[model samples]
Target: MASTSKVALITGGAAGIGYAVAAMLATKGWLVNIVDIDQEKGVVAASIGATFYKADVRDYHSLRNAFDDTMKRHSRLDFVFANAGITDPRNFYEAQTSTLPPEPSLALLDINLKGAVTCTYLAQYYFRLCKQGSQLADFDPTLVIMSSIAGLEVYSPIPLYTAAKHGLVAFARAIATPFKESDGIRVSCICPGPVFTEKRKPSDADRLDMVPMETVCNVVSELISPGGGFGRCLRVLSTGISDV
Candidate 1:
């Protein structure tokens, strides 16, 4: 069926929080574009009104093409959830003693921090285009950045990850206030606690202490409503930081 609704482009929409957001938004009548590097997962997401895109988050040209392709295919883009991220923890303190495979390169930083920022700026470009282009159906655009609680506080043990998350949170806030600079774009960030899932297990500590993914989903869903949460900071934590 031809969709007559606005579209949401979700980076990393093939799994994790990105997938969760894509699913909910699709059911809500938004034509979702799931952007991920995983071809298999991308194919699966295409079955659910989400057009899966294979693009590396760190590459600017790759994402530019992806974003351009989305606009050509969807005709209008309403929201962009910068959700692509790397879930790795081998950095900073282990390179000196490592004798294995070039030591997990600074790829995580490139993908998680730099990638998110670039994707966001790309989204902003489209949002501005929508705001000005008369051919666009959805005049107002939104950006839902997937930051983590680690950004708000020093919760995670991995320094690199925590630093990146902190950067994401600060980026969101910095754009939102005096927010007029963003061409009326509603930029918001969601800081989720350790969400329970099966694709992988959390750290040993995370096993005994975690919250349901649904809890986080509910918050994002609410943020979509008219006058829903935006332009301000909110936190979702099972505890203050150390749940032990």
Candidate 2:
């Protein structure tokens, strides 16, 4: 008999929040497909019972190739985690005075906003194709996007990062209803506050109030359940999580 375990595709699954979510999903009997730019970390991910694909999220062709290969291997995709992103420490306001051609650093927008958009577009396409001619009326595919507390509130240290996150929040909300109506694919965003990852600075004020990585993983696990979340943004804090 052929195994029919569900498949989950996660971008930036090599480390941090993305890796935590991928590991948790794998434990729940899911076949995890991890897409990452770092080949070394990708190899590590593959060793942990995940299928690793090397790709740059900033390039749609690279991301699409990974998506196609996963579909070919698993025959179905039940979930997509568009979790690839990078932060910019520069203050855009201060950079406006610079004379360089690319002063403010567009890397944040490219990897965070554009990458997420590419993932969402591909997720919808793949999910729709997977659901073609399905008779199960209860089928619900999902696309979980990664946002941050910056998406909901103002964060001054990283202005570009904040704007990118805010864009993600808007994107998720705008497409959630349409995606649900079109293909029963629920779209949700996770807005976590101050997770203790490599991205966190040791001298930061929020260092003492960091939320555990497990909490974010738990929230993601719950979101994957049948009919659990749709068109919702869950704000996870050190204290508790709430729908925002």
Candidate 3:
């Protein structure tokens, strides 16, 4: 075990923003358990000194098993990042036939909004367990949700993705105070503008407005710190981060 006993569980941690955060925390000696649907990334996680659990965020039971296994192994959890999400797969407005429009796929909502809600519920439950077992007078557990700039504004191209992110911000704000009072758990949402990740090539023209992966990871570090505030949606841009 590391000198610090702090532990974090992150979804979608195999790559992108989630992976960056996990790697950052691992370097800081925080025990990181990554729960991602991509099983192939398990080795990548291990390379960073983080454990990886193969589980889909949309599957409640499988996700819960990851949580259970993490707690069983580490016996403590200080942070949980609900970062799994995806963009709208098909056109919501497009009509396959002249008379009737094809049913819009809601997979985005299931993975983004619903998955986040489930993670939040499980986080609170385990946070309480950690509280009961801890000897420290002030044990604070934090939940950091991944929202997007689209959540704050209209993103016409991906309406479903925008809606899911918006729900995350609202959900975090709605439960922050209550969760803090009830479980001594702080909750906050990170709303970043388009982020530069492996999937996003630098050659793309839109890269100008994209936030760096480092910036997003740094924000996660701040949010999990002892003094990290609750209920605020911090927006990350190419330049810096600010409260939204």
Candidate 4:
């Protein structure tokens, strides 16, 4: 409703880089909506002047309902940050097999790969809708997806993570050329090496690579900031990795 400020919706905005992005956007004078499945994270995001919506990125119905409610409450949607993801460091070959040989849990693939695809599709739909919709002439929807450095250089031991991240990088790049010139919606992705989060731990072997969560925040802030993209996956290297 304010003249200069805008509205931003961040998926996975409850913690880690998501929260950091929310904080940065809020400071930049954006009305932020932090979407995540974690209720606790939602509460935290709400505490920081952001509205919270609990939705699993993999579920279309959930996301749709959340977005519907968000738009109704806010009256407009301007930007989207699809940063929710899961990380499973297990190599594809290293996964344990049962005597029955059950289907793999594939939690990493579901949350990381499929989730990003789903989010982008939905976000793109809304971006186009805003362009066409009469009530939202001000809508210039921007999308910022979160990928990783592993997306560029294949990580030997973490094959699935790399596959998912690499998929994201390609997905975003595939759209960048056409969307930037045609749609007027800017799309960019940030591929951070390793941010210090409770979910991630760099061992003796992986100890040589990583970055701080704050540094990652800075990168995410730059991605959807009305500018274009950095084509390759962003890599936060060794010195940053050493601290983690």
Taking the tens digit of each residue's C-alpha lDDT, what string does model 3 give over 183-236? 889999999988888887658536578787788888888888888888889989
**Candidate 2: which stretches are off by over 4 Å?**
1-3, 95-103, 135-139, 198-208
TM-score of candidate 3 versus the correct structure, residues matched by position: 0.94
Highest TM-score: give the candidate number: 3
What digit string (tens of lDDT, one per residue) describes model 4 on residues 95-190?
465677657668887888888788777777666665664355455667877888888778878888888898988888888767768767777777
**Weakest 10 consecutive residues of candidate 1 by summed lDDT:** 235-244
Model 3, residue 154: displacement in angstroms?
0.8
Better of 3 and 4 by lDDT: 3
Report lDDT per candidate. 0.75, 0.87, 0.88, 0.74
Compute the lDDT for candidate 2.
0.87
Cα lDDT, model 2, residue 169: 98
Candidate 1, residue 79: the lDDT equals: 80
* Residue pairs in candidate 4 whose N, alpha carbon or C atoms collide under 3 angstroms: 210-241
Order of all candidates by TM-score, from best down to worst?
Answer: 3, 2, 1, 4
User: Can you write out model 2's per-residue Cα lDDT over 55-90, one digit (the tens) per residue?
Assistant: 999988999999999988877888899999987766
lDDT of 4 at 24: 83
Model 1 Cα lDDT, one tens digit per residue, 76-113: 67888888887765646653655665645778778888
